[model samples]
Target: MNVEIPYFARHQLSPGGTWISSRQKSLRTFKLADIGEGITECEIIRWAVKEQSAVQSFDPLCEVQSDKASVEITSPYDGVIKQFLVGEGEVAKVGQGLCLIEVAEDDTTHVESTETTGQSPVKTPVQVTHDVAEDTPTEAPPSVNVPLRKHPLDPTNDLSGTATTDHVLATPSVRHFARQHGVDLAAIAPGSGRDGRVEKKDVEAFISKVPVPDEVETASRQQEDVVVDLGRTRHGMWKAMVQSLEIPQFGYSTSLDLTRIHGLLPTLNAHIPAHFLPSASTPSSPRISHMVNPSALYPVPQPPSVPESGRFTKMTYLPFLLKTLAISMMEWPLFRASITPAPAQDTNKPTLTIRPTADLTLALSTPTGLYTPTIPSAQSFSLHALASRVTHLAYLGRQVPCGLTVKDMPRRGGTISVSNVGAIGKGEGASPVLVPGGGVAIVAIGRAKWVWDVSDEFYRPNDDGMEGERRLKIDVSWSVDHRVVEGAELAAFVETWRGWVENPERLIAVAT
Candidate 1:
């Protein structure tokens, strides 16, 4: 797992070098490909072939596990594996060399050189120390530079160059922090940790040294640092978060009265028929009611598979929220559109791509990471149908090795996203992130709480008949791309959405 490419081997064929003879030995370096969209790297689970092993094109080379799923990599050439640059149980970055292939040419006579006509020797110097404290200045160690040049196929000399990690050694948390601050890991001074791995403290130190403007000074902090290795999903999230900075976002917050939905849940939940219940004789039978018929208000092109029972046992306000949002997207085409930048050869002006149906992404959080699975053509699904899709997506995301696949996530993706921020805990609202390539807007659903309305005439609501006329409301936070959407339009959209939430009977009346 701790495989490091020898310095001599790595420099034998520099990027600028070329072969002398027509039958000269050629080395083909196989770099890891972008396995999935947005997947920057994957952990090498195991190697199917060893060094010096013969392999034909399309042969299984190794198996890799991304945070999303496990995938097998294949050989691209009919040659022997020269070396495994990345070993088993190590992370391999996209576009980085994974192994070297030695392609032998069919020639009998050829002359080799010693002084270097084809390749140039490279000498690299490395520095090592236990720690480098700001206050402590230690004497520099003696300099030792070695010139390395050797045939990559030769296995004679095992000269070691330096103790270095095959990949950047910072934890996931540190990587996220660095990306957030726009700090390049390669530009930072060598970390004091083992294998010269960068740590959270190093990033904090780097951030502290950055000079702030005199008018806008930041308070200094000396807090303990923590490092976390980001899983596959978290890494994907990190990349999305970094890309989000490019979007100019404008937010709008409004409170929706959930009093009607709160009162309607008990009735809807208790209306389950006997046929919908799982039979004792058929243990595998679906227990939840998946029978959702399309109506004039909400139509379904095709219903998603029936989800397992328990999640649908009780009705919640989420289904109603999804239903209303889908309807709103159908009316407002801008919210269901994405900006496609123009190509270099074309005009500089970008164009917008509008979707015909409302495809909504449900932002669900699990132990693994955040996943937003799109519910395609959401405008067609009844309340129960939408509820079924939400339950299934959440179940899939929580499964071990995550059952969600690339097919489940559309390339164009959903036009709008909804996050149940209230499920985690009580909060006024959250400024949800609209991932760059994800959707045009994202709305956060805050916890529903009881609030007293003081707008009533003095002592008006306190009448015996009108006693306890309090409002039950939830906060709705909207984040829209300013490049595509206007602030005034977002406010109007929220107001329209609030009308649906306040009138629960409208949803039921439209149900088949």
Candidate 2:
């Protein structure tokens, strides 16, 4: 009768009858795990570990960038990297193998074995053995067995016989630079970057080496087109512009006499509150005279300290123009109204939501993009306060990534929007476009210029015997949703605003 000895028992019963233990090496395919939030795939931006590199558990393996954010992938087990399944710039889907790692596994556990006997096979406890080698085929875990799709950016997946820019190894910014210069990245062979990766310097070198005829260069420059993805703010503008097509708009252009405000600006700037002035230039507070009765003095209360962000030492004509516009909007409620969608039951009759206060939106151009921040209840704010708010908005617009938030731009936007295009250009007028929900009206204020007032109403003999007086004037173009605002009403509204603008004293009388 022969009895089969268990593999574990045989190994344990050595020449000295002592137990022995061993660890086996196994190949594991490290897969890209789900990095939360409905993210299905991400592009491998950089690899921290290279092929054949040793790594420990929790060590960073690679960094991946998704549509939302960049995340770093880490090793799950202590192992030596065998091969990379995904290269840099290549996208890997969740559960897809990212790389193969050789890990050591202890095989000292007991397994059940059968021994052949005369009647039936008897079960015996034995050790499980594994024949894993360095070149052994690696099997992905069952959970990561899904078929891998060929990524478009993968070089091996390109079947085109010719090399194209898409197949070149370069970053998105490098590609953009190449595109802008009308240089074909595919033409720049043997790039200077590591692994022949094309770079901005390589593109510049290519351009410098290649010379073309002047006419050809001009023609190529005209033909070159670079595609850019619109930013968040610009994308919003695109959608609004598209919606603008649904509404009928009419434009009205006219001139405003800024002769009075021009003189008033210097006085306003000189009297800017100490709080609004820069710390270096802030004037010392005046002390009360001892001779005056304390009761008669009435202690002139100081205005609230202006935040550093909102401080401004100088005032421009824009604040006064905006304030007067707000006052006019108060008189003409239609200009202060926003169009609201009709009720589900009554789709034909769209309603107008009239806001009691004039919330003004300024079309501010920033480095990031165009932003329209609202100045709520513009009429209620004093001129100085309005100027400070404008300065604060301008400051916010200059920040990187923009500092304006939803609070600065609420869902319920202003009734009318103003764009001071004149600040950057010497344009006389502009036909501003009015988008739905942007407001009932939009106006572009052009650059102001000094001109002789030759009109019969204002013409006067000057000291030099000239028939007209030198006056400062600015051009303003208005575009309104014709569906809600008639041409006559818009003209009348401008006239009402002009009443406060031409006679600047009225603004001070009604100043809050």
Cα displacement (angstroms), candidate 2, residue 455, comes to 0.4
Q: Would you estimate the TM-scores of all the predictions? A: 0.56, 0.59
RMSD of each: 16.1, 13.5
lDDT of 1 by residue, 414-498 (tens): 9888899998899997999888877889999999899875554223645465544577889999999998889999998887787
Please give the distance, in angstroms, between residue 199's alpha carbon in candidate 1 and its true position after superposition. Answer: 33
Candidate 1's TM-score reads 0.56
Cα lDDT of all candidates, in order? 0.69, 0.77
Top-scoring candidate (TM-score): 2
Off by over 4 Å in 1: 1-227, 273-305, 309-311, 456-459, 464-468, 509-512
Indicate the residue-level lDDT of 299 in model 2. Answer: 71
1-512 per-residue lDDT for model 2 (tens digits): 32233332222212332223335566788788655345688788789998889998768899886544455667777778988999987889998999988876544433222222234222333233343232211232233456444333222354355566655666555765787678998898457776677877899888888876699788887798856877546777888889989989999999999888988888888888777777888877556545565557487776787778898878889988998999999999898899889999999999999999999999999876788889999999888899999999998888644566556866688999999999999998798998878889999999989998889977877787889778899999999999999999999999999999999988767956
Best by the lDDT measure: 2
